[model samples]
Target: MVLPAVGDVDRMKRRIQSPDYRDWRKKVEDIYGCLHPVRLTGLWEIADKTSGEVLKSTSGHILAPCGNRRESVCPACSDRYAADAFHLLRAGLSGGSKGIPVEVADKPRLFVTLTAPSFGPVHNRRFTASGKQAPCRCGRYHHERDPLIGQPIDPDGYDYVRHVLWQAHSGKLWNRFTVALRRQLARAAGIPVREFADHARLSYAKVAEFQRRGVIHFHAVIRLDGPHGAVDATPSWGTTELLADAVRAAHAATHVTMKAFTIDGVPVRFTWGDQVDVRPIRAADAHQVEQADGTISDDRIASYVAKYATKGTGKSEAADRPIRSRAQIELLRTTEHHKQIMRTAWDLGAPVVCPDCHPDGPHRVDGCGCARIDHCATCDNGGYIPGPLDELNLRRWTHMLAFRGHFLSKSRAYSTTFKRLREDRQIWRFEQNLAELGVTADSVTVINHWDMTSVGHRSDEERELAAAIAERTRAARKHRYQTERTD
Candidate 1:
């Protein structure tokens, strides 16, 4: 994928000169300039809902956005997702939009961050209190971009198994933390855990981030409201101080355990690292991000959490898509330490085999009858497949490092949802199109039937052109947004 050089306009000359170029450009613009546009062949019609009289009918080709939220994969759709995330998060924070009450802004709100416990010491670049660069475990003051940073100081001694297992159960750990948080809040109020929900509701929107050490850290906006949720006021006792205390207490109490992995017969446990940070969110002007009194502004917190949703795992240049075979690990562009992590996740997820048939390990052999048979006097069917943390589909999630959680998630009471936001956009689009057709929404219903025709460009020339178009469109959109904000 070497891009064209100098004035290599020749690469895209054909597309730019072709008669279909205008149509192609228009289609790309309609999808907000998607990098990997899906080609669709579809039938679209607007007809009377009651009489079923078709007022408009057409059959043609169209381009749709890929809708990938990862910035590494599709910036166009990623920005779209981030914008939606910002609104959803901000609605819960500042309110006034998305059916949330404006007074919810005064609710007891805290910004919480929870991190992974250390598996082992790793090389890092740290700073002293006065801002001097501190020495790493390797006894060196590493540069910020040093390639060796975050790699295990003792590669062999580093607990790769513990790290991988923790990663796989991180989502479960977060779920447990929320439950514990509710319990802690209730205990602080001297109320039973079961009756806690009747007194107050806990709502949060959290996003997962991958630190340089290749583990997930969650940043969340926690708000306390009455039993009915955002619209209802929090009880008189639900103060920001109390909410922060409960969050810290919950972080301290939450731990998840897995089956024994060693001959010692002791269970492996996972818990959050000691770096729990809880900051109060203050109401301020949209321009204020961090207030003078050490509180974070609502606008900044929403923007901060939304960006993480587009992130990839850690500093590794690993595959964005799933890996089909173990051999692909060697081809990854990340550091050897990340490679080891991926390798551990892959191997630990392998099926257990009979000691007699494949004593060397469960590495499947060609034409082997053992893997196919159960209780065949050979392989014992692998005993439900010993996946990492018993997550049977760990192999399927190798690209994600076995963390099977949504990057951005929220409780039911947390304002609006991503689905609802997208549906609203669709409705607005429908209205715009209907107005153009001079049709009333109550009189006609639009129907769309589409099948995939193809995906992506057929040549490097088309890809380069599409990339250019995407950049231009994105810049224009940014300019428009900025202009509107100024106005």
Candidate 2:
């Protein structure tokens, strides 16, 4: 075959050596990384048409394996995921191609907190005015360094089982509460519950948190969207106080549908307790709350939610690396304070010993004070002994039952989703690529599939190959331009 002109060869060589060429090639590969593995290989079949099917194929190494978390497991992929999430959330808060408008900031907004009901009285650190110490509920003037800060003072009396059930149903409880809220809002608006969606819409972003006792609490940024959505304006009747009132009414009136089951001929029903709190979302309020007890900041709230989204219960050693098995318990590197809790969780998960054949007597903690025992000096002996370690184990056990999900959970209309926004972004990028290549058509179709198996630096030989490709593209462009000039 006849080679291109000498000038074309020289131009190609220079383009291959250019830094811009290298950068563009890297970005093209990065886009491929954003695609799923199966789709990446299929992209090779897209016909170039003008270029006789430029079957650009690689070793299929840049694709992500699965769900990305910024945790130590996959930092590179996690960073990309976080960036995408940031843009997705911000777009809803501020108008983007997703049709969100800037006026969203002025809408009625509230930061609400709803909590699980009291399981039992715990050792709470009470502080008086001027920061003086008040006696704890345990009747001991516990110091700041006390180990029982959150431990239940009455573990046996505590409704640990109920607490666990609350967690499993918390998501459902929120749904019921929202329904009640809409009814209340409609009553205030002088409209029917069925017509409420047409007048004003409620939009919110919420995150679930596990308190020290393993009780799940919710923190949310609740916003009032206009009749239709972000594009429309809020109704004349809507106000922050009205929203707050509706929230309060919803909280007081809402109840979860409990499952009724008969255990050993005893009929039982489960339900949520009466602890609930809802507050307005204001930076000033958080500052005021912080003055008394450092309130959580926005960044703190986001980070806290993000951190727990990847974690499961502390019971499963594999679920959360922090948990330790019996064999690995000795390898704990935490302070003496945390070790006590960790050890308790491990010991509780072990199998019970055979009553007749055991040398160690029992596989349990071998405690002198049993929770089931009736009368002991520490407890009033009415089977009321409250062991702190046992309480910790109960907390862990309850968490395993309740919070068996990722942290951030919300309804369909809470906000624009990450996947939808990401797909839109990919479409925009593809369009931009078509525009740069001067492929203008009334309706262009994308045919290539992208696979992103890797995300870091390429080997030297691969870089050289990419560089050579860039040079050829550059020379081809120059040759076209020169010919057009002669014409």
Best by lDDT: 1
- Over the stretch 319-417, how does candidate 2's per-residue lDDT look in tens digits? 234343454545644333234434444543334433233334433455533434553454333333333234234334421433434455554554577
The local lDDT score (0 to 100) that residue 285 gets in candidate 1 is 62
Per-candidate TM-scores read 0.90, 0.58
Candidate 1 lDDT for residue 425: 91
lDDT string, candidate 1, 1-487, tens digits: 9976775456467678999989888888887767788999989999989999888786898888998887667777887888898999999999999999898888999888899988889989889899888888789888888888778888898888888888888999999999999998999998999999899999999989887777788999999999999988898889999999989989999998776464257788889999998999988465666667768988778888887766642122456889888999889888888888889888877766555545555556674545554464543454334433454477887777767788889999989999999899989988887888798888898888999989886677777777777788779988997788731
Worst 10 residues of 2 by lDDT: 33-42
How many clashes does the backbone of model 2 have? 16
**lDDT at 412, model 2:** 54
